[model samples]
Target: MSNEPDRAWWKEASVYQVYPRSFNDSDGDGIGDLQGIRNRVDYFDELGVDVVWLCPVYDSPNVDMGYDIRDYRSVMDEMGTMGDWEGLLDDVHDRGMKLVMDLVVNHTSDEHEWFQQSRDPDGEKDDWYIWREGDPDEPPNNWISLFGGPAWTYDEGREAWYLHLFDEKQPDLNWENPDVREAIYDMMNFWLEKGIDGFRMDAISCISKPHGLPDADTGEDWFDMDLYFNGPRIHEFMQEMAAETYENYDVMLIGETPGADPEEAKKYYDDGVDMVVHFDHMDVTYGPGGKWSPDYVGMETLASAGDDALDEMLNTMDLADLQEAIRYWDEGVGDEWNCLYMGSHDQTRAVSRFGDAHDYHRESATLVATFLLTQRATPFLYQGDEIGMTNADWDREDIRDVEARGQVDILMEEHDVPYETIAPFVRNRSRDNARTPMQWDDSEHAGFTDGDPWIQVNDDYERINAERAMADPDSIFHYYRRLLDLRSESEVLVYGDTEYVLPDETYPNVWAHRRTLGDEAVLVVLNWQDEPRDVSGVEGVESPVLFGNYEQRDGTTLQPYEARICDLG
Candidate 1:
């Protein structure tokens, strides 16, 4: 007999994002497949997640690690067949967990039939992609590609340049064309009918472009995403898509909106999109030069540096800025819900980026887990995060990610930068850090595959694998389970209002927030730094600890990277 509004299932559920290429390989092909995922349903149940979001497994050239998809209805040869996918879906459903597929509608591979047909200027599908006439040298405008070059690639067959916001092989779809939108909607419906619970739309903000492709107003050094990200027709297209495909079914929708602020995010929410993955908090470390500047850790490549060098790079990030960015979204979302995450395929490992991955890996990893789960939003836990996975210690020769390789090629080939000078920077920030094969056991290749892994496994796999974590009571994986259990059992954690404990104070190392429901409340205190912090000013330190990273605690003193969820008595 409560008066609270009825909420959707997604609002009360936690998501686990599985990057298929690195999750598990059942066929010994050194690549993760649908069968491998089907083989791990019990693990998902053990982890206590409600939804499993699979990254792209569609047919692809893998120029951008499956983002450059070649076919909408077909499965990748390496990722197994449509039969395997259907079987996997059935297995997930049998476990009472929902499966959400990654939706990549902004673009298609240059090898896609539509793009191939559009390559012919006189063909009926000529307008399927954005094509224009311009000087080959000028590239239609000064717009820089996200992969580090001109956005336009010249096509000899069409005698014109086609726009590719990512790698040249991934052509941006012309959503301005109604036929193109219809085709995408039909493909989505095909999957919806096949029993997917939802979709995690990839780079969805880039779908709508201005009427005319214009030159970037910014300089040539960085990306000019402002010109097209969350463009004019974005809301219209999203609404049309919802009506065409999602309106008929009860499903969740998560849009990956880059460069969107709180105000922009509300537009998607208003358009019936369930939630959005905004990058404001993720990009807090970027300086005026954005991701390419030395202010960011990934841009600093120390050729033979030690842990001290890495520590110095990590210190460039400001905790106050992080708090401000997080607070901006947390407060700005208003009645609309938010999606929370610490790491993903496109990001460096969360421990390496935001916590001390080397010295206090366990403490920092658990601390981040508490922060992610205790918030008033749906948490999406990336694969390998449960076992406290850290970034791979990679060198230039070990690089495989398309974006990292593109940066290296640009620095060394175009700018004559030394390989040694930029190699470490790329390693520290490579997307491959998160894409490393899952650490399942202490055996060869971390038991991800009997064959050689597509990417190198982390050297610390012997200590961080899942088998070891499951057996140890104090392991990071267990802490995640306990946190999820706490969330599932407490209504306040899921439906309460969050209020920062020390709003006007200057305590940079401490993050204290209270989640309060009608008659229940809990306080989450976290020390974000690797030093002892004075949280005595917070009145609830003496209260009984509901859950914590440390086994024992003393009054008012929080150890380095310590976290506590205390009942506010």
Candidate 2:
């Protein structure tokens, strides 16, 4: 709210993700293009999402969306002409919103010119990829690719196995090679120089793989090192990258380090790496005894996760560790936190996984929002999440994520299960559960497209689209807009010290966290259940309801799933 701007712009700003292939299609090609993103830059500016994290539109074979990089410099042939990319950058900046690109340096598609040449044993660029000879009957070490089977794939021409942490076609780059690192930094600098703001690093934490190819302890033909997740020299290399590629420019690094151990996880923000898409806290929300557990539905009425579950989940897992993750970065190397919500292209929709999206969605969504926005980091809002988007109707053939499809098939085959038993599991676990096109309207294709979509749109789009939410004051979209507005206007929500309160007699389903900045205190209270509740923490001076899904009198009873930000007394 102050006239003075940007002590930490990324921290204060709201980020909206653009999955380019599905965002909006301009050429009637069924896939969304960069121009589609260009068309929506103004929409983002008006919607109050200050940052735009664009999913890869880079030239690729489209094996894993756009993650399999073929050429880092060229825009995808499907996305648009290079002229469209230039115009797209101009449009984003003209709207006063920041643009972020996906940095996927772990591997490149087989078709990439580098990989093609690297496969030739006699070629000068042969050392660019990790390739080694295999014993006649055996394989090249006992290393399995993170994707599924063996990490090393035999190349017919070279008669040697090449390291590929993912799909065999996308060979891992040997970053130890100075030329490779220089190429990556130069590619980043190329984009940064092209007026792009920054990047959202894909599998960034996996960049510094342990040089000595190590084997997994699982006693299988697989190699996975504790070091691979967070290698010894990662910080050094990343800092070097920041200095060479992103140092001079105003860029934000949002890292996605999946399934990282707590120790290695903190390394993300070390060396001034900005915000990390960490999942330590998120794992707490999973079901060792959640609804899917056979015992859960049988239990008459479940105890609120706010009370019983909080104590159980947080007892072993540190509530303060989240703050610790961010603080470790602040104290060690100076950098900010990246705030986030429950959904991404890789994550299931918040409503689908966290709570019953059908009935108690308001309460569940508000509880998650309060937790995400009120925390000390910067916040990124997934597309259609503001309107409380849920997963597509649960099924198997409908799935889209390549990883989930292959893994689920393997799981089902091992269990000797019928498709019925496996379908729901895949539905719950698949990334495609989140990648369904943005729910824009109640029209055919949810107003996302006039043509057929690459992925199925959620059936409830008629009821859950943006048009309906934007019109209704109580809609989740309106609540998010209000929250984004409040975040834009208040420093307390952005960087305040948090104080959690144990729920007691008054509000049974509420999870309250007090955020304080010196004398100013902000109380964000969320109703996490489908029942009415009352709370008693606002015991100070003339209190005002700063924001809420429902309009409540000073002492009015809060309905199920109500959310409110009240001024501290």
**Could you tell me every candidate's TM-score relative to the true structure?**
0.96, 0.87
Stretches off by above 4 angstroms in model 1 are 1-6, 219-221, 295-305, 413-417, 502-506
Query: Model 2: which ten-residue window has the lowest total lDDT?
Result: 294-303
Question: What do the candidate models score in CA lDDT, each in turn?
Answer: 0.86, 0.70
lDDT of 2 by residue, 1-569 (tens): 23232376777788888788877776666678887777767667767788888898889988888889889889888899889988887877877888888889888888899988987889978989988887645766676667677777888888888888788888988877889889888888888888887788888766677767665575432344564566667778888888888878778877777645435555666665667776644554445542123132222222233322332232222334433443443333323355555678877777666555766776667656766677667777788778888766446776667777677666567655555544444555567767787877898888777788888888888988878888887877777777888888887877776666534445445566677876778777766666776554534312577876666544645677666777994
Q: Residue 448, candidate 1: how far off, in angstroms?
A: 0.6
Cα RMSD to the true fold for all candidates? 2.1, 5.2
Q: Which sections of candidate 2 miss by over 4 Å?
A: 1-6, 219-225, 259-270, 288-338, 503-509, 536-543, 553-557
- The residue pairs that clash in candidate 1, if any, are 301-425
Q: TM-score of model 1 relative to the true fold?
A: 0.96
lDDT of each residue in 302-328, candidate 1, tens digit only: 445565575457435676677777788
